[model samples]
Target: MSIRALVYGDVDLNTVDGSAVWAQSMTRCLAAAGCEVTLLLKTRVGNERLTAPLDGAPGVTLRRPYEESLLDDLGPRGLTPEQAVALITRLDSERRFDLVVLRGRRTAAVAAHTDALAGRLWTCVTDVPQTATGLTSAVVSELTDIAVASRLLLCPTEELRGFLESSVPAACGKSVLFPPVVVPPPEGAVGPGTPRTPLRIVYTGGFAPRWNTLEMTGLPAALGRRGVPAELHVIGDGIHRDPAEWAKRMGRALEDTPDLVRHGGRPHEEALRLAAQCDVGLSWRAPEADTDLELAAKVPEFGALGLPVVLNRTPMHEELLGPDYPLYAGEDLDSVADALVLATDPQTYRSAAQRCADASGRFTLERAVERLRGHLRLALPPAPGGVAPERPLKVVIAGHDLTFFTGLAEHLMALPGLEVRLDEWEALHTHDQYRSRELAAWADVVVCEWCGPNALFYARHKRAGQRLLVRLHRFELHTEWPRKLDIEKVDAIVCTSPYYADLTRERAGWPADRVAVLPNWVDVDQLDRPKLPGAQHTLGMIGIAPSRKRIDRGLDVLAELRRRDPRYTLAVKTKQPWDYWWVWNRPEEREYYERAYRRIQRSELLADGVVFDPYGPDVAVWLRRVGFVLSTSDDESFHLAPAECAASGGIPAVLAWPGADTIYSRRWIHEDTGAMADAIHSIVTEGRFDAVRAAARDEIAAKYSLRRVRGLWTDLIISGGFPEPVRPDGTVPAIR
Candidate 1:
């Protein structure tokens, strides 16, 4: 299928300028590359002349705000950059464009910062801080902001790309080279003749002083001194940077110079024709031209006209013409003169022009088409062969609480061709049977988040050819839910850790091949927030339900720490036993929580130290005040509190439950409450809490990153197959 593209440039195509010409080339080339393009145009006056080439071009369609009467509605600055973004939104809503190419910095910046478009942007930013020192704190920040808005940062020259990626960290790896294109000559245009006397040299483009246009007239005098009289013709009307001064300077330079002829601006075709008539072309620019990271558009245009050009001897020019090309010239009159005199030599002239011809070949329309196709390919990569069908696999994820798997769900939903449906059970044991059965029949795969009644129901009632997967956490493993599951019908059992997988296999009598481990995804970026002052004194515990979470042990650690440092406090962020009707009904569970509360109130240190924060989805925020997260359970499938704490830039003081070391580092685990107190005190006294936090954060990020885990889940859901088994140490293998 052809790629659908939305192209926008904040340029007026009615004029014959570089930006205008670039827009024209871009629109034509995108169509050539097989894209069904909607080129949103911003035209001043009229664009009939400029857009003539694209009038009947297949695969190219034009949309102008002026023609749409949006210009009349929005008033001046016709098709403003922000309006461009709005137009993109409107068109995208009508029919999604697979790719978006943004050329103007203002439009790109607005789109990027607004997040109106996310990773779909293929942004081309020509102007940015160039020098290392020029990238001040503010400039770096600005560049970083824009960097996130684009999937690729398009550069016309490798030198510029290298500079940007090296200086601005945000640009690294995202920068790509898309060289300046040479617009193909008009059909049936004239070609250059053999070398002639009174060597005719032409310079065409904007009369920017930076381009050194005024200095070219002196080349005739310099060439004459060398006994080679040269006729210098200059074409262009536009002026940049102090236009009045440039006009005055250029007028004085051109007046009464018999060898010099200045022609006002004309169409691009006329300029090319004039260039072909000349013996050689001039692209010389000022000493301080912004050429370090940019290439002169006219340089290749001169080459396309089969005319050897003299320009600033920069790296980009050297890359185009070999470093030893005979026509290399500096901006000064003598250097250009010296090169013009050399062009008088037939052997030198033909060789330089031949090099020009060869260099221009790289920028031909066909090559540009291929490069652009490659860029689009990289931007939107296809799924692995045979793994992802053109039609998305219908996946239904059923669970009471989808909080744990939300990231994975979102990832699957965003995937190119993966349809994800959720069967949210009212409770672990209950759901609308009719809806559940209907979803089971429709889904290619049904994933039960917990091995509860949902898994058993799906295993028993799943339609033929539909794969069923069940995730087993700690609580569900102890229940009879696993024994009831139809092991033969179940495709795979997902365990968060290796120890739990072993337990699931042993207790449920499920075969090893049927069980696979995919750990929980931690939203690290969300959790990694700055901590409040005195956060080191606060100990945090997420849950203490039915007393198995060992909130008493957390209070014990706090009590012991406060004996040495009274600043240390225990903050239990959990739902009280009374809040849960099931746990409250258990006499032992009620007694356990009552006893833990009595101990916290009775003990002198823990009385003032222990404070219970309400449980909610705002754990990341609550962790800001928590320096050390405590997990004192007797056993765990995979206690996520400590890993999440580590992710939130806090050290975890965990009691070494059985198999705990497999998932958490030994440095974080202690044999008892006394050892836990000692570790926390030492970190506090030595001011090593920051170092410990960094280390723990790194470890958690490497292990439980949402991006990696989401990918594993995607593989499992898409392929209806298990990923590699978890190692004995709880480490998952990289997806192959």
Candidate 2:
């Protein structure tokens, strides 16, 4: 799959501004690296003369403010740096970008706070504070914020990276050196000929106070004083007005300088050709600023043209040009003049060109493309099925009736490294389609609590790299949801019991390896409270609405217990039968519950012995009044009540309903009501109830406490311990 990128900056690609040139060239470089690129320019559109080269570029798309109506509302102000982020988010939501390339301090600062752009930004902040005095607390904080949100910070030289890392601790080891991507000119260099008396010195790019364009205008006169006539060609029509003096100085010089030829702004290729026609590319700047952090963009552009460039002798420049190189010049006229005089010598000129040619190889289009490609390859996990490292796994717990799964969701949420959101459905078979779709797109792992409509929705609409984990309960195995699921799209099928896991494998025809058993866990510490007085004489059951839950069996056991001891009473905690529309709607379910209630009401012994308690989340508080928790069902994936009962300082009296013997301790499971009653009586009469309670609590803590089973779920979902789909290309991209 082609990597999708969004290149954003306030740069006007219509001009030869340093940032604008960097943004455009990087876009081309990314396109060369097999990335489908969209370049979003915050400035006005109409500089086709300067931007025409990128117009026909393959896999490249350019956007401008006018076309997007960013200028219509703002008029003279145009698009704000903040609004650029709005457009980015709008574009991103339509089709997500794997990576976002951003330049400029204000743009990076703003985009850093946007949640949609976080952790995906490749922020290039070349305009950082140059000196320790300029690197104030506020500056450090701003860059640190950007670094926190960005995947990597882009730098042009080690000096810039060192400056950022040393000044702002957050920037340490978070930056990558990204030299300029130089697209060499098609035409070969034209050198000095005949006597080579008039040395041609060319200066391209923005003219500013620090850039020393005004000083460059004085070069020809300096060369004349040195008995060497020279021509200074100043290309590019734009200038940054940060310090108005330089703009005013260059303005008057452009109009008055006799030896300096002002060639108006030309297309990139034509401008490069113009610079190549000259003998030397002039990039010398004033020494008033600590602009030593970055290598000048034009130096490489000149290098690409096979021309020796005259630049300041900073360490960054020295690194680019060898220390002993002949033409290191100052901003003063004499030094520039001496460099120009040296350029007029054919043998010295050829050696400088050769040096420049060798240095230029390090910044070529091919090398830059490969560097960017490798950086992206190592930094970003592959698309279709990989996750970025260091970021929390965004998990969406989706399904209806999350009663059984909310504890697991809470456990995951308690982890500092996981982001959890609940997508509650209106019912088992219905969900908000838009919300489900958005959640599915946003989540790294989607856990459908029950393999119902929610599972079906996610499975059918699953996107690449998004894992779908559907947990199957026993009821869903009997439903049409399992049969209709696109099981191939699901990464793993979870079951609370191995029996159900195996049953799901058999019923749904799922691969045995794809299913895992992660049982329901009780918070043992939370439920291990002081049992209420006379709790030993009480029997407990939760949720008796469904007739298959075998509430009738619970009653027979309670009657048997009461026969042995009159103090024995049953407490059934759940919504009454008529409270549930699903259960009360069915004629058989209503009749079955009515009969059970009638039997309890008519029997003088059981009428007062059974108490129906209201069901709520206060199970730990209510469970104090229960002693022997009964799990008498025809079939169950896992009845959580017995585990919770054991946690609540009570012994579980579970009937051997199908797989109940395998799930619970054999000592707890009974064959019939008589055995269940006999076990409860023996514990109470022998006065070993407290001992049995402690033993049961310890057993529950070891086996089914939230603490015990949490890692299994966390590893399966968060750590992705389940089997992953092998991409059709037969590769799994490593997340570095």
Per-prediction backbone clash count: 0, 1
In order, the Cα lDDT scores of the candidates are 0.79, 0.79
lDDT of 2 by residue, 665-699 (tens): 78788899888888889999999999999888877
- Candidate 1: where are CA atoms >4 Å away? 73-78, 187-194, 241-243, 251-257, 381-391, 394-415, 419-717, 720-736
Task: State residue 155's C-alpha deviation in candidate 1, in Å.
Answer: 1.8
Task: Put down candidate 1 lDDT per residue, 273-351, tens digits, no spaces.
Answer: 7777888888888888734578778777878877888777876677678789998887578988888888878888888
**Which runs in model 2 stand beyond 4 Å of their true positions?**
70-72, 189-195, 242-246, 383-736
| Cα distance off (Å), candidate 2, residue 503 | 42
The alpha-carbon deviation from the true structure for residue 66 of candidate 2, after best TM-score superposition, in angstroms, is 0.8
Give the Å error, residue 179, model 2.
0.9
